[model samples]
Target: MRTTALLFSLSISFGSLAQLQPIAADVYRWKDLKIEKEQTRERRQVLEGSARDLDLLEIHTSALEPGKSPHPPHTHDDVEELVIVKEGNLRVTIKGQSKILGPGSVALAIPGEEHGFENGGNTRVTYYIIKYRSKLPMNIDRGKQAGGSFMIDRSELTVKTTDKGSRINYFERPTSMAQRFEMHVTTLNAGMNSHPPHTHRAEEIVLLISGSGKIQIGEQHKDASVGDLIFLGSEVLHAFTNTGQEPCSYFAFQWN
Candidate 1:
């Protein structure tokens, strides 16, 4: 491909030199995303990887028929993908190993790993894939990393207390194979919030799993319900509150 100055800039920004960060703060209601159809499956793009957003981070949700695969097992040269099952049983295949991850389960696919998945049950399966290429080196040495795809089931999430609620830490570079992120599931009781509105240097994505809630970004506020993927960019003050009668839960993953 012919390289333009803009393209060159992007290359440098995504090349192990923290030159750019993907995506500024934003929020996406699942119902608002338009699905793109394919022969074997369909997907909705929530965030596209671009120089303006950050160098190479993307967010999308996909659904497949009971017996279909999104594609054959494959590998990316530089992108690491996180698959979070939203519904049904998703059979993920990495290399020659395979496992069926249920709803709320998380699967990791590092760059250079052969990975793909399909709905192995009788019903359709919906899931979200967060793929990104980290420009910054991890705090841990790469040679010490245990690289491969693995599943973290929802049943395994250990609940711990927070000031107003509780949470479960699922993945992080220090304990997981990923070099760029940490993910957690937090729950807030009805009409409660963990804290006041705040902002941070890291970018994050919050996907609601259950109950009713509200997310405030800057001066604007919106309802947070099941199936919504809310994106909060660096330095954009945001906060949340459970608006429903039951506890609200969500999966939150952020990168430095």
Candidate 2:
């Protein structure tokens, strides 16, 4: 009877695993906009994953062709956006300051802040966009006629930034996870194609979407490839580098 029970458990586990689906590629392609005179060609929006249970939304990969631009300067009064560059370079205009972001770099645009982007480089630009909405909206309009107004209050929102090897571009109040704080990860490739050695107040998990490198977490420094995941604890000095011929790209989520 014990053996039969064990076999049944194994079957259930396999069934659960089989039910999981990878992030769809078609979702990454942004097709709602018309191609104009701009040099931009390709555009897509891929929904990587989301944790509805934890109020977390993850947009795995988004690409913009050379000379293409996203929406004009806009703001989400209640949602916090974290963007991480995967390949090529992107020019971000935040409050009129234009900065070129390369692979492994990240930026955070606060609610009510004017922000937008353009593929300022010759290569295609891909990046990860994560959105944390305190209150999920009842309707989502993907068309151009949809109202561009925000429904939440901006003064009540709080924001913060931290610098690890990859920068913690922006953060709000920490979410409580088993008595620990939680923050979104926004890793950028800046110095020497990698980040510096530093620790943080919360634990973190990393997912590599592009480039190649090694992740040093505590004493375990392991090779990182596309689709690799790394977990880190609070106060653990972690770092990463671009070990491949091209640039490295990844995102880290910190949860205490």
The TM-scores of all predictions, comma-separated, are 0.84, 0.45
Candidate 1 regions exceeding 4 Å error are 1-24, 51-53, 137-148, 161-163, 174-180
For candidate 1, lDDT tens digit of each residue in 139-183?
223513654556787887788998768899887763222345678
Estimate, for each residue in 1-256, the C-alpha lDDT of model 2 and write its tens digit.
Answer: 9999999999998776445443221212223422333343343433433332223444444568788786667776655566767678878777677878887566666555578878879988876666554323422221112322221211233333334233432333332112222334344443334457788765455767656677776766677677455645457788876667664556556542
Candidates' lDDT values, in order?
0.79, 0.54
The true-versus-predicted C-alpha distance at residue 254 of model 1, in Å, is 0.9
Pairs with backbone N, CA or C atoms under 3 Å apart (clashes), candidate 1:
21-54, 22-53, 22-54, 23-53, 23-54, 25-233
User: Which of the numbered candidates is closest to the native, going by highest lDDT?
Assistant: 1
Off by over 4 Å in 2: 1-53, 134-205, 209-224, 227-251
